[model samples]
Target: MSVDEIIEYLRTLPKGTVVRVLVMDKASGHLWSSIVENVVDGDVWCREDVGTLIEDKDKKPTPENIDRVLAAVPGGLSAFGDWLTQEGWDILRDIYDDAIDALR
Candidate 1:
């Protein structure tokens, strides 16, 4: 999906939905995960958990870092499949499939 498609899909979700996403640091090949606590006006607000790669390493993982990592990812949100765990992917897939089916 394109960025616009992702934004549109997110808009369809209920507020305060918990959605996990993988974030990668292009320079270090380091990866982290965040849980999106809410989506507002095409912007996703995430919670950086203690187990996040950067956070676990005692590094300060700021909101800017999350945004930068997301921006650096190729193919935008569509590329999330490469990083999501099976359970995470399944959750997202179910949501996407349900949303698509609802339109029929």
Candidate 2:
């Protein structure tokens, strides 16, 4: 669905309703990976997953691995203290529009 569709659908849900949002880094690639993240700012959060994947084990690619990450996902936000951007902030600003304004 489009961004507008997602926003409209979310608004229909009751307050405090549980929802899962997955942001994947790779669009097309081999089957892979686990996600480990920290910082819990609100009721919405993911489970703790410090475990390793069998395919990812012993496959720690350096240098090039870092380059691959920088290329694929260029925008990010860290909500620990405040809202910020890496790049293409306008994309989010336009997509979220005023819905994110009340978040401030």
Candidate 3:
């Protein structure tokens, strides 16, 4: 699906609906899952446990801080969809299915 389609679909969801995405660390080749907590103004706000392992005096991971923003535009959504594993795609499909069922 196109990014616009994905964004429009996401907008149909209620606030606080959670979506999961996998984040990869380039330096360590490690991967972790992050949660998309909310969608606002065409951006998906996320929180991840990425920066927790490092000891940084200047910065820290907190709930108030957003880990990343996934743009609702075509490029952004396309990249996100491309990054997903088959299982991740299945999860997203399930969410879409559930939304459709709820609307019926």
C-alpha lDDT score of every prediction, in listed order: 0.60, 0.46, 0.52
Question: Which RMSD does model 3 reach against the true structure?
Answer: 14.7
Q: Please give, for residues 69-98, the per-residue lDDT of candidate 3 as tens digits.
A: 223335675665465556565877876887
The true-versus-predicted C-alpha distance at residue 27 of model 3, in Å, is 20
lDDT of 1 by residue, 1-104 (tens): 56588779978989767766556666644555444545432222233432265577776777676667667768875675455546565877886887877894
Model 1, C-alpha of 6: deviation from truth (Å)? 21
**TM-score of candidate 1 relative to the true fold:** 0.30
Model 3 weakest lDDT span, ten residues long:
40-49
Per-candidate TM equals 0.30, 0.28, 0.23
- Ranked candidates, highest TM-score first: 1, 2, 3
Identify the runs in model 3 with alpha carbons over 4 angstroms from their true place: 22-35, 38-104
Residue 91 deviation, candidate 3, in Å?
Answer: 26
Per-candidate clash tally:
0, 0, 0
lDDT of 2 by residue, 1-104 (tens): 87689989989999867676654434432223333334232232211111122125654445455345434533521342133232336666787778977786
What number of backbone clashes does candidate 2 have, counting pairs of residues 3 or more apart or in separate chains? 0
Which pairs in model 2 have colliding backbones?
none
